[model samples]
Target: MLDANIKQQLKTYLQMLRHPIELVASLDNSAKGRDMEALVLEIAECSDKVTVKLDGDHAVRPSFAVAKAGEAGRVRFAGLPMGHEFTSLLLALLHVGGHPPKVAPEVIEQIKGLKAPAQGGHFETVISLSCHNCPDVVQAFNTIAALNPAFSHVMIDGGMFQSLVEERKVMAVPAVFDQAGELFGSGRMLLEEIVARLDTNAAEKDAEKLNAKGEFDVLIVGGGPAGAAAAVYAARKGVKTGVLTERFGGQVLDTLSIENFISVKETEGPKLVAHLEEHVKTYDVDIMNLQKANALARTDDGKLAVTLENGAKLTSKTVILSTGARWREMNVPGEAEYRNKGVAYCPHCDGPLYKGKRVAVIGGGNSGVEAAIDLAGIVSHVTLFEFDSKLRADAVLQNKLNSLPNVKVILNALTTEVTGDGTKVNGLVYRDRTTDETHTVELEGIFVQIGLLPNTDWLKGTVALSPRGEVEVDAHGKTSLDGVFAAGDCTTAPYKQIIIAMGEGSKAALAAFDHLIRH
Candidate 1:
C-alpha cells in the first residue's frame, strides 16, 4: 500500500504528472526508471521500513527483499517461514513487481493470459487469516502480494461474496483463481506447480465450474487437542485430510498452564499450541487458520460445503468438529482488562510460571480445590476463596486441603476488584460475602475456576446440541449430521480431561475414516 496519507498525496501528485492510462501503461514488468513510481517506492519504504531477519546457519541474517513499496519485499517475513511457510508467495511478488516473478516462460505467458493485463492486474489472498482455529493459506498469498503490487491480496472470508464465488464456481473456499477466473490451485499447492500454471494458458478460469465432485477423506474442524489428534491420525492413515479451524488453537491458547497432557509433564498453553502445531505440520494436512465456517450445507452430491466468513466454500467427504470451549468469566470489572496478564481460568496451564508467587483461586469446586492444591506446590501461597461457608469439593480433596500448609481457604468470600501493576499481576481487593466485609488480599494471579462455554454456535443448526450448546455426538464421536463428526470437550463428554479429549479426537478421526471409506 502506498503511504496512506503520502499515498493519497502522491496519488494526487502522480495523477498531476501522469494520467491513469499512462500510469497503467507504466506498470509493465520491464520498467527500471518510472520516476513517479521510483519516488513513491522510496517514500513508502522509508516510512513503513521494517527490519527483516531470517534464521541462518548460525546467526540471523538481514535480507532486504520487498521494495519499500511492498511488505517483506524480498526481506522481511510475515512470520517465521518455517513448515508451511509462504516462500513461494514472496517470490511471486518479486516476479510481478518490476522484476516480474520468473515462472517458466510458458507459465509467464499463461498467467499474462489469465487476466487481461488491461483489466489491470491479478487479485491474490496473501497471509493466511489467523481468525481463530485455522489453516493459514493467506500468508503465502500475502507474502507474494505484499512484495509485488501487481497482485491485490485479500484475507478470505468464505461467507461474504457468494456471487464472485459462484461465478468462479469455487468448490473449496481457498481455491485461488486468476483474473480470467481460471482455477490455479487448491490445498497445499507447490510453488513450482502453481508457477507452472502461470504459463499453461491451457487451464480455463471456470475449470472448477465443470468439475463434478469435491471430497475429503477426513475433514477435522477446530484446532485444539481433539482436532489436532484427528489430523495426525487421518494423515498417517493415508487419508486425504483437510483440517479447518477458525484459529489454530481453540480456548487452549488462552490456557496459561497445563499440568497434564501426558508426556508434556507440565507446560504453558502457547508452548503446548506450538508443539501441536509442530506435530500436525509433519503430515499432508491442510490447516486453515482464521477461517470460520459460516454455514455447513449438504451439497446435492452429499459432500459438505463449509461456507467461510468470506463466502468461500470448502467441500469434504467427512467433517470433524473439534471446536472447543472457553472459560466462563465473572464479568467483573478489571477481570476482562487483565485477562492474559493476570486473570486466568486454568491453573494447570499457568501454575508453575508463577512459582513462588501469590495467586487466588475462586470457587470451592473440584477445579478450584485442584488449582489451589496445585498452586500450593509452586507458588508462595494459595488463597482459595469460596462463596459458601465450606468447600463444595469432594471430601477427599477437602481433607487433603486441610493438610496443606501453604493453602488458605476463605469462606463466604467474593472478589471485589483486581489490583495490578499495569504490566503484570500485582494485588487484589476481596470481600467477605456473609458479613459484607471488604478486605484487601495482596495477590499476583487469580485463577477463576468458574465454568466454560463451547465454541459451537455455528453447529447448532446442523447438529443436535446439548442444553449448553455443545454438539451432541455418540460414543464414536459421530454427530447427527451424516457426514459430520465431532470430538474433544466440544462434545457431550462429561470429563474435560486432556487424555480424554485426545482419545475422543482419535475416535472421531477413526470414525470419520470409516464413514469416508464406506461412502
Candidate 2:
C-alpha cells in the first residue's frame, strides 16, 4: 500500500525512533481491512524497530493503533490516515516510539502533570481527510495521549463512517467530543487551548505570568500574514519585538488553497502558515500565541497598553494593529443558533457533510460562485442567492458556475432569514428585489461567503475607524494615535490580499521604527 517514494521517506523518519513500536491492526474480511493490514505490514518493513500485529480487538473495524512495543495503545485511527492526516500518522509513530515531540518543554511537562476527571477523559474527534484543520486537532490529542496515560484519543474519519457522523449530526470537520459531551466545535485549535480548557487554574496562572512581562519596543496585536511580516521587519532592527495574538495565522488558517501568493506556484493555507511561523522564529521576535487582546489604551507614561481578556496588560513603546478580519455573518435569526449545525462559513471544510443533500450558497462574489462550483460534485443541488442584480464574480468563474447542472444561480435575491428546526437548518427565506415577493427553499445546509468584516471592534473608541469599522490609516500605515500603526485587513487598505497585507505590515513596521528613533 505504501509507494516507493513514501517508503523511502518513512525509512528516513523511522531512523529517529529510539524504541520499538507496534502497528496493531483490527481487521475483518472487507477490502478496507485488507488495505489496513497491507499498510501495517509495509510499515513494519521500513525499520527494524517496527512490527505489525493483526490480532487487534479495537471496536472500530478496519482500524489500527500505533503503540510502544508491549504497551497498550492510547491513540487509534479508525480509517486510513492519508491526505492531510498523513503527517499525523507519522508524528504518532515517532512520538509513540520515544522520539521527542517539537512542543515546548513546559507544555510537555504540563501534559505529563495533567490528571483526568473522575470519569476519565477519552477524546474522540470526527474528521475528514480533506479538512485542513483536522490534523492539528488530531496531532494534539495524540500528543496528549502519548504523554499521559490518563487520556486517550481516537480519530474517526467521518467519510469512512457516514452512519456515525449522521448519528452525531456533525456538520463540520474537527468536531471533538469527550465522555460528557462536545469538547470543542468545528475550528482550528492548538494544544495550549485544549490544555487551558482542561486545567481549571491555567487561565489565572497564565494571566499572572503575562502581567509580569517587560515592555516591548514594537508589539504586534495579531499573528496573521501582516503580524508575521511586521515581526520579522521589526526584529531585524535589533529592537524588542513581541507578537501577541489569540492564535497565529488568523483567518488564513481557514483558507484552503492559494494560487496567487506571488512567487509560490501553489500551496495550502496551513502549509504556508507553518512556513510563515518558522520564518518569524528565525528572528529575535517574541511570539505569544493563544492570547486575545480585549482593549487598548495609553498608559500614564505615554506608552501604549493593550489589555487581555484575562485582565493582563502589556505595555509597548510602539504598537502595530494587525488583527485581521473574519467571515462576515448574516445576522438573520437562527444563523448564530445553528452555526455548526447547518450554517457554515468554510465550504472547503464543511461541504462534505452535506454530500447528497440540497444546500444554499449565499452571495454572488468569487467566493460564493466558487463554492457553488465546488459543491456541485458533492451535493445533490446548490441554489446560489445573490442580492445584486447580477453576479459580482469574475467572468470565468460565472461561466464555470453556469455550466454545472447541479447549481442554480438567482440574482436580485435578498436573504432575509434562515429557517431551521431548532436543531439543524431545514429551509431558507429570501425576497425578490424586483418582484417584492418572498420565497423559501428547503435545504439541509447554508454556506455564507458574503465577505469579511474587520476585527477592529475592540479598537472602536481608541482609534479613528472608518464607517466600515476598518482602522483609518495613512499611506505610511500610521493611525491617528501617535506611536500606533495598523495594517492588513483590519486597516483601510484598498485590497485585502496576502501579498498586500505583508507589504503593509512591512511598511507599518518601518514607520514605527522611524517614530521610535524620532522620539
Which stretches of model 1 miss by more than 4 angstroms? 1-215, 246-279, 337-359, 365-382, 387-407, 412-445
Best by lDDT: 2
Per-residue C-alpha lDDT of model 2 across residues 13-131, encoded as one tens digit per residue? 99999999999899989888888888889999999999999999887888999999999998999989988999999999999999989999999998899988665778889998888
Candidate 2 lDDT: 0.92
User: How well does model 1 score by local distance difference test?
Assistant: 0.61
Off by over 4 Å in 2: none
Q: TM-scores for all candidates?
A: 0.50, 0.98
